[model samples]
Target: MKNRNIDFSMVLALTVHDMKNSLGMLLNSLDELRMENENTFDDSSKFNTLQYEAERIHNDLVQLLGIYRLGENNLSAHVEEHFVPDFLSEHLARHTPLLKGLDIECSIVAEDINGFFDADLLTGVLNNTINNAIRYTKTRIRLTANEQDGYLVIGVEDDGEGYPEHMQHSGTLSFKSLDFNTGSTSLGLLFVSAVADLHCEGERTGHIKLHNGGPLGGGVFELWLP
Candidate 1:
């Protein structure tokens, strides 16, 4: 067998590596602000704004990382069994300060549900979904998990103006397509799709879909993993 040279795209991926480092610094600064003025504002609203922006930065970083992984073909799924409720609670705790700040209440209901999954990638995907829910939701968002047909279905639902009917069926990032000039890049959607696709083994794989009708009667993001 002959030895082959490594590809150059891996080196190019490093060019976009600044986002994570800068965002991390920004999050650290926001943490300091939260501690210094735990009661400075009327409510946690100020910290909420800080948290929302920080979360945005974080989601962008996640997308950047995913892109790098894809370029290197190193984005592999690492699934392990875990309790859904505990996982949801842990992520919520990490973002609680920001949620309370943004005036969005999050409720997670994952009773009697457990599954195997790639924790780190799933965390990033859920964070993006929750961030979008927070952006469009009027007041509340719910995370629900249940087992169906030998698959674990996790949903992020919001209470706000739902997506257009046509957008849901397009199977593309309709929001980004419609508003290309806006700041809402399709990075998060791309990250979600990549993570979902990575969760494949033999004939079974995880998949995700977008819907507009659910208990919340707004946008619903569902991920199904077998």
Candidate 2:
């Protein structure tokens, strides 16, 4: 005649929300410091690196939370048509300061096409992709979207040396096969892979892939969604 009720999902959500808010406050403080002391650090500023690291942490937290919710069957895509160019533009804006600090040129190429996907989830993957590009790019990076072979393909490219041969794969990676020695990308790749697989339609399943060489002759992070 006794009832014990514990809402684990709500508890998880509240905890994650609190961490997200704290991270936001810290990021804002770091941004203010950068603005007020722009010239305080030399070209080799550790503070700039700190900012990038913070961004990476923020991205990881977001994607981790998304993947957890998705795995628990508590999340669903709100797929919609988005103007490809505007989407790329908004993504680029978020990393503008970092790109500028690194003297990297970022651009987008789209063919007046609209992409059908969940913008919130897709942005998490794009954040990782673009941030990686910004880190490795020699001087330029590009984002492009187009419909290909009955699926919408979005790609992020950089002008630096491409991924190592071991890390370059043709399709979505299995969790057991990911390489941990490949710098900080292992987790990001896994997160993106989960998000990609979450999108599906009929006989087609979404996927993420890696390759060398493209418009930038460097690394490319490609995501395909149906």
Candidate 3:
């Protein structure tokens, strides 16, 4: 009798790790080329391609790192009070090129939004959601914040194809179930879920939810901090 044994989960994890490293190197090389050869391309296509690839790499790395941390139950989080304007400005500044290349309009809607949360964790969570919106959006994306029911609510909305029914259902069960094969769910949502759960001070815990309708009328990703 012949028996076959395979630890598919371990293999998949290793493969993702290797790809993350490779993607990082590729991004670095592209950055060097962009800097050393500013006038290299006559058209914007090459630059746009580079921007998109870099974003892809960045997204992948975020997912891989998050998954690795989850396996160890050592995904540490630091929550602190941060200004909404500063947070939104920094995120938008980093994606300016990608937004311009895709002709997508980005905006922030809020007067004041101060919250205590892990900067890096929230950044990764919001970045992934916003990046997803950028890809599926028609022409606009927005980051908005509010306070409701003793929780701080931050949302990323897009004017694009609204989430299909199945995906919405997956989101309901858990963000991690967001179908990795599609790449939209990947590690980002899982990481967001972890981060949200980590935002506890006393008996309050933050959480994330996906919705189909909002001002954007497409996808609305909300992170609730309690």
Candidate 4:
């Protein structure tokens, strides 16, 4: 008898891809249902929780797929010039319904400048970051972008209790450093770091910073792309 080896990573990747697609469809349906029955969903905590959890899971699946690609050396950024303010506004619009339902005041403050990066990769990072902010924020969240030093800095700030001291850092993160024993593995941060590293210019590459105290006086997640 011949024994066959199984590629578990490939299997997990395929499963995550399918789950992501299914969750996308579910989110679309939830949006439509909310629009059609705004009165029912708007003030229902249970409904809000349902939507939020689903969205969070969807974002996690996305990060997992990206990580899988990164492991396979298949992930890369296709940089392009994009207007910062307009990009922020459009990205924020995706969560408008959920934000309104939760009574969270979300705002964007970006300079009218063009940034060169991969929109799709950045969108993935922003989606996860904003979802985390929405979960932790007290009642407000802010998104900001501008050119700083020699990089384009995009930030997500929330009015929640800031990150604990140990979690705060300024550098490129590695997935291998994640500790599974902790309840939070910081998978999203690893994926964000990978995406950031993909955007390179001359001698500098992108990186992320975590610090407390932004405009909202809370935890801030910053992505600096060179």
lDDT (Cα, tens digit) per residue for candidate 2, span 1-226:
6676878877887787778778868878877776677667324457778878888778877876876776677777788889888998898888877676666898888778887889988888889899888778899999998889988899999989999887787667666776566564487787788778878898788998898999789999899998
Q: What lDDT tens digits, residue by residue, belong to model 1 across residues 136-181?
A: 8999899999988777888899999987664473233422354556
Cα deviation at 110, candidate 2, in Å, is 1.5
Query: Which model scores highest in TM-score?
Result: 4
When summed lDDT is taken over every stretch of 10 residues in candidate 2, the lowest stretch is 36-45
* lDDT of every predicted structure (CA atoms): 0.77, 0.81, 0.75, 0.93
Of the two candidates 2 and 4, the one with more favorable TM-score, higher being better, is 4
- Judged by lDDT, which candidate is best? 4
Reference-based TM-score of each model: 0.83, 0.85, 0.78, 0.97
Ranking by TM-score: 4, 2, 1, 3
TM-score of 4: 0.97
Higher-lDDT candidate of 2 and 3: 2
Q: Pull out the clashing pairs in model 4.
A: none
Global CA lDDT computed for model 1: 0.77
Q: Alpha-carbon error at 163 in model 2, in Å?
A: 0.9
Cα deviation in Å at residue 203, candidate 3? Answer: 2.8
